[model samples]
Target: MRPAPSDLEPVSRTAPADGTARAGRSLPRVAAALVLVLLLLVIARLPWAGDLGMHAATVQRLRHSLLDPGNPLVDADTPSPYYSPWTLVLGVLARLTGLSVFVVLRIGALVGLGLLVTGVLRYVRTLSSHRAAPALALLCLLLLWGPLLFAWSGFLGLNSLALTVSYPSVFALGLGFHFWAWLTRAVRGTAAWGTWVALGVLWALILLCHQFTGVVASLGAAAAVLAARPARAVLPRLGAALASGLLVLWLWPYYDFFALFSAGADLEAIHRPLYEHLAARFGLVLLGVVALACRARRDRRDPLVLFFVLGVLVFAAGGLTGHYSWGRALPAALIPAQLAAALETVSAGRRAVRAGWACVLGAALAVGAWTQAGTLGYVVPRDRLPAAVAAKYRTPWAGYQWITRAGVRYGDVVMARTFPARQIPAYGPYTVAPGYPDVFLPDADRRAAAVTRYFGGSAAQRRGIVREYGVRWVVGPESLAGPGLRKVTAGPGGQVLYRVVP
Candidate 1:
């Protein structure tokens, strides 16, 4: 049976009266954090960068075809058979708002941002109940910057900013924070059944969002529970784990998610230097380490602190082993925990010293977030098409617009070398044969190469490529026209569409 609202208050181990007081006290910090998160999200206007467009397209497909027999996810004919609960939520939002999936993608980013801030605040509170630490640590998170080890690198702060587009990863990281914090309470015997239920729900959500993230969170949860007094902690942890497992089994293809563990094991090593991974929160890592050393004699065996420190090392190792996402999630899971610990260690300092540290931390986070936000100021627009045509495509903007309006159809395979795969779904419910790059899609590389060949290959090669991939229409420069292909429409600029000869 579900618990009553009154029952929920005790879950936090705070009496009703005390809980209200704490909530009142925390409200200002939460409000300020909310403003900061919203500001970063709004300023970034995080567009469809990277593979976000492909995910948007999936949501588009789901929105239109949920009841249709040709639903891409259920149909075995489609190239991608993967599942994404996040896209399902986006689909529902798109329907409710009557907005395009592209817009919903940005909204998802905003939601992820809010959750991330909430999780960070919860995490910081675990190490220190000092009222100011959440605000201070969060400010540093939003504004700090560290040295860039290379030209094409991102810091931890930048990674958070990029959360504007990485809905799954960001959402998972946010939930992982809450999961760890809840697990901390469960292990300490301060939590009620509701807390275990909350942890399980959060874990289930993370699993549905992304399997790799679920694995990382599961490790952290298991560590926290195991390190606690096992006799007392085992039942709650087991209950939470069972609830999570049952939820996963009920809502998702749990086995498929498990298979993802070894999916990219064979890929070439793309190892990042330790500095690039840690630079974003290098200051926190340094301060936390220094504080840990300074208090080694007294606090050396702190379970929560040790878990997070080991997390940094584990994720660093995972990155070295070619799991880049694991590496990126490290700072999200560990930094706040370490920062909270650092603050607790230094809480005995004079007021002036504490204020000075806070100021320095805030400035560094601001610089980092601002620097990262600058990179996204002019990212791809959220419109159905880019505002202007590129000279390289030699196509007028109207030409593509006409193609989108006249020739595109549901599930039609459109081929274009210069046009982005994202544009097809944005403008019409069509698929790009070799569309945007998605790590999950097996045929992404093969189809991407075929798109190149369709535009540049000889007549026979183009036909073979077209037949092989079931190319419905080719949209590109007129010069690339070949036999067995009749011009459907020679629109303005260099835009020309050819129907594949049956």
Candidate 2:
């Protein structure tokens, strides 16, 4: 009654009906990959590029670092940059490949997403109940999860990193990382060569990319592998993986978190409404129950159920704090739910049963594809960029460029806020008063005051800034009717340039 990929049989529903030969096997695979890739690129290339701007900023800095070494050109300071190094390589690699920023982002989106789907599909074939694992895990996940992730990832740059976290949870709960590592080591013929070293480096790089998630993934993988090995072998395997983690930890101090190192994947996000978390766990349990019921009563040998059950209990208990705390625990829920869905397929009774599950899974996949490829993706992103207005103020990047072109010397202690300092491009060798989020880390109120005093001040206040910031020239986008602005440029997002005439 064991349903495994090694024993996969074609579904009986559409089996060579009426003696018509099955469609060309080779074609569908290629077609599926191409359609998905092209569609993903389109969604990623749109003007908004979603939250990609934030990541682009991050990658921009990392890219500049490679060339300047002394001064990486990334926007300084961000809120949550705990694990940016791991993914930055892709950005660096994209620049080297000579693609535009848009194309490079699209490339990472395609590659990362493509690999994610691959992992799902492969697991689906494991046939727990014919529901979940690599092939994209059960069809419902394929349907709903794909569309949700595709649509969200296309619309949110931060979501890309979120997916980076979610993908490894699949591996942690599905294939078992420790098993893969052990296999890598066991194959001395393979391991003796540089393959081991390369894997080590690759693993380390991934850890660097999204340190928190990467560490969680590594721990989950190592644990899964350890569980599968002999009692004696478990200790050795555990030691090796831990050592690898330790080596990286030595380089980056934050890797020392025990929960992250222990049950790290469990807390991957900060989703709220604690009740929702409970509901999700309950749903997975329900699905797990139904999937296990399809198997022979004696087949309780499947530890997949227990894996999911324990995960549910632990995560629900942990969710109480995940909202208030740094949500590093959400990944735990994703694994069990995926397994329950994908593994459900193996219990198919006849043609109808298999067809039923496939239809469900197929619908999920279709919606995912449609969401990424749909016309809805072409318009403004979920978060409106306040454009036409955004266009008026010279971006901070552009403003700095303006000063260089004019050969003007901006004084020390200029104020900085994304909107207020939109005109301030790259400023060098000068400290600003109210500064970029990277440097000053001020709250919105302080930022607002600085903007009010510098760009939006009354004519008298503008005159007073000479005493405030020690600079005579003030140039930025301030609302025309606002207190102290003389219009430099106007549209929706207007520009104001003033010189304090004290």
Candidate 3:
């Protein structure tokens, strides 16, 4: 049974009579709006970094061949997990509008950002009636991390969001917040069979878009259902929803969603970093941990507490078993704790307790903001930034557009080293080997070996690799001179572009 209104702490929903008090209440909203605007400008700049090329390559493939867009990074006909429903839609937009992949990503960033902001507002309303809960929750979500600035696709810290706003992960995460809100309402109130089915389909789409974020979303959904404590009648509806979701996953023709489970061995190494520096990277969220404990004490089935527990269990299992990829679920644990801290600040009954919580949260936010202050360099000129803020800024990678300018065309195979290979495919050229890991591609190992041999092997070995992959162009440093190779142009970082001789 739900608690009586009188038993719950009073939430401030109306502006105070005093003008100063009204203005003070509005400050958080204003601050949050300003931060969002800064993020929008950052999206416009679209700083090039990790996985940008991979996503760009996906869209580029879909644009040219919607039906059979093949492998995104390599010239193969294998299906790819990256070709999700979201990217297919993006591919259609890029084709119809004749826009660059980056331009399409910018549009996607706008939509994803809007979804995220409104989703937070909608979900927070279910937790607290306080007028400031949504704004405070947004702030806490973005700034409740420790001083070390960590940037990853599924993570939602300010710096991380800035870097990954254009990624499918952001769109998946935005949809996840909405998923939680919808599940909460559906479980709490009577809903038709159709509603449950729709919710199930939405859940599948989230998973298809970004698998890591999808895991986080699934955990949040489970927490919502468990906390609602539905009656026996709801079990059938839940089963129907599960069936619908599994059907969609099975029917997704682009890639085998279930097959991804077997591919975990290839991913553990890359995700190992997620397990490192936990205290330094996420220590500030301990405030939220305290708040979650408070909530759990009052109600054992509290959704946030359950969410945190589930996330910790999975993350701990990953570390113990060397399956570090499960660390992507860290946000699942962090998010509820952050929301709890924000909600407690506004709903605490005692004035002294509220004030103390606000002070600690405020100090934590200040430190976090400074830790992510380097984000300002995305909008402001780096040279114009203060020394302290500028010191934190890491320069984004300059792209491989230079090779394209020298006549590298779509579907043209370019022999490049690992770093250049990572970025070149973004401009529509195929690399000899994929820059990132590819679980589905059967010849991934062979392709990688071919690239290594072409760069460091004997002349006969280089010729054999070029012939085997049909390489038309090669990109490397100035020292990369050889017979049957003609210098085409130079790019950033003293790199030389070479074309194969007939």
Candidate 4:
């Protein structure tokens, strides 16, 4: 089923590896993970958003089982899942050991992120199926870790932002979908891939544990389903994808709100004559269509191609419409499209093919090489930690692991945006907090006031709003813990208790 790699032909895969080199190759991946892991660990100290630090801390507590497991996500503020179960799991493991919960949380977030990057790399290699896939995979992983990480480093918005649309969580969802797809297949008396089922269960457990990932994962399963199967199986797989998607959407309350809220937006915004947007949105894809026209004559039914098509369609529609952050969603399709391009580059026999491959290859190499450098002079790579803080990470409970000869709750029922609060609630049975991305944590009236304060107004208006929100001590990640708010005793992340001045 694997394609062969081509230096000239447009369609090729790597030759099947024999045991020795295959086994030996593991070292490079290990080395890559180690490199990224260490860098991410160092980045953690440089002020990861206060919230990301908190999430790390929460992961620490969960690993220790310092709290009950069932509490939902944190902070209803700013529209996304704050909890990341995969990161939390690693934190839990660290808590079990003697490592600082802060270290554990930071390390775990980086490790999970690194592992997700590895998964993308392996997926790229497998999808490319080439000797060069390994090289390309590493390069792409490096791009993500290096430039992307650097660009998003301290800014820590949703995409690279800890709770904001973390793409790795989507990676988890893809893993979960693959699992459930196999489970369904097995139940149907078709070949069952227990491996997928195991993966699904593990991620589902993680999703249950944290909400941020759960949201992205929920939507990403449909895209991953195609990756797990070939054409003849597309119908069944699509159906499976649809069912899984529906299930995921139903479980979380946010989707409905997002959908509803988006619907409420000026219908004019949603209804922009489809043509104006689609043309701009799918300009690249239309070019791909030209490529497809050239390739279709040769007879192709490639999974990566399918991914490209679906991704293009979704990206175009999203950009054209007001659907959930289309740019972030674009990556699901981008991965496959990029891999297909990489594979085809080597596959084509033309001398020009090598030139084209060289460009892509060079870019990927740069991603790997400069992942840690923060350059305002340079745009940060996607995978590396960011050099600037667009917003400080906040989640109070994530910091300060309780050193209990025996465990005790401090009798504080603090509410937070999402992740750390989710983790913290479990720590103290008496503590109450938002279930997930809670609206209540940040006062609704205040958010309204904040909007008036920050939006569609003069600079003076924005400052007033910022000050007003800060004064209430109710807003999140932004104004909640600023200058007007005084810090009390701190946790590992400087998890501070800011009192609204009387």
Q: Name the best candidate (by lDDT).
A: 3
Worst 10 residues of 1 by lDDT: 390-399
Local distance difference test, per candidate? 0.56, 0.40, 0.92, 0.41
Q: Summarize candidate 2's per-residue lDDT along 1-502 as a digit string, tens digits.
A: 7888545555543466523222322233454455444445444543332233444433444444443321111222323332234335544775577655445555565555555455445434433322223433423332333323232221111223233222222222223333333433443222332344444544554555444345334544443343344345335544564566456645653233332444333233322433354442233334435654454254443434444444445555656545322233334334444455545543456757755755564554454444433333233343343543233222212224444344334223334444434223223212233222222132434445655665555667655644554554455555433444233333233544443332
Q: Name the runs in model 3 displaced over 4 angstroms.
A: 1-21
Best by TM-score: 3
Instruction: Report the lDDT tens digits of candidate 4 across residue range 117-160.
Output: 55554555444455655544443433433233322221121223
**Per-residue accuracy of model 1 over 285-402 as CA lDDT, tens digit each:** 4545554454444565455555565676767676667665555445534453545443643373674665465455445445444444333333333243333322111111222446
**Candidate 3 local lDDT, 1-502, one digit each (tens):** 9988765544333333355446546977998999999999999999999999999999999999999999999999999999999999999999999999999999999999999999999999988998888999999999999989999998889999999999999999999999999999999988889989999999999999999999999999999999999988888899889899999999999999999999999999999999999999999999999999899988999999999999998899999999999999999999999999999888876867877888899899999999999999999999999999999988888998888888999999999988988899999999999999999999999999998888888878988898999999999888888887899999898999999996
TM per prediction: 0.72, 0.58, 0.96, 0.52
In model 1, what are the clashing residue pairs, if there are any?
143-364, 143-365, 143-366, 144-364, 144-365, 144-366, 156-280
Report, for all candidates in order, the number of backbone clashes: 7, 62, 0, 66
Estimate the TM-score for candidate 1.
Answer: 0.72
